[model samples]
Target: TKMLRHGEVHGKPLTSKQKGLFGLLAGGGKPTRLKKKRDRRLESR
Candidate 1:
């Protein structure tokens, strides 16, 4: 929902946050980077 709305507005990708959050919840795997989240946020802007 967030990514869809963001993609509609910004015409850019908006998925890393969702992916990172999902990865956190899922647990036990490779870690996600904060830089990725920051980059995605900047792109959303």
Candidate 2:
């Protein structure tokens, strides 16, 4: 994974929680409720 590779390069491996936060900050966390709302809207169409 890019995050793991990044950690390796930086010499600081991130924990699962930290990876989750990184994903959130990068706007790649589709687990957010906003993603669900967008999915619902698409389905309604």
Candidate 3:
């Protein structure tokens, strides 16, 4: 909706939210090492 408005009328590409979400996905979204780090910490304790 907003992207359509931007390109059709406002002339921008996309919103910041869309860009951020894309970036997050491209970068693998969540912290991939979370469980590994937790296990390592538990082992050290």
User: Estimated TM-score per prediction?
Assistant: 0.30, 0.40, 0.37
Weakest 10 consecutive residues, lDDT, candidate 1?
1-10
Q: Candidate 1 on 1-45: residue-level lDDT in tens? A: 454434433565647776566556456554457668888999998
Better of 2 and 3 by TM-score: 2
Over 9-28, each residue of candidate 3 has an lDDT whose tens digit, in order, gives: 35556667666555566667
Between the candidate structures 1 and 2, which one is better when assessed by TM-score? 2
Candidate 3, position 29, lDDT: 75
Candidate 3: regions farther than 4 A off: 1-12, 30-45
Indicate which candidate wins on lDDT. Answer: 2
What shift in Å separates residue 4 of candidate 2 from its native position after superposition?
5.9
Candidate 2 C-alpha lDDT tens digits along 1-45: 587448643677688777776677677555676678999999998
Assess each prediction's global lDDT (C-alpha) against the native: 0.60, 0.71, 0.60
Ranking by TM-score: 2, 3, 1
In model 2, the clashing pairs are: none
* Ten residues in sequence with the least summed lDDT for candidate 3: 1-10
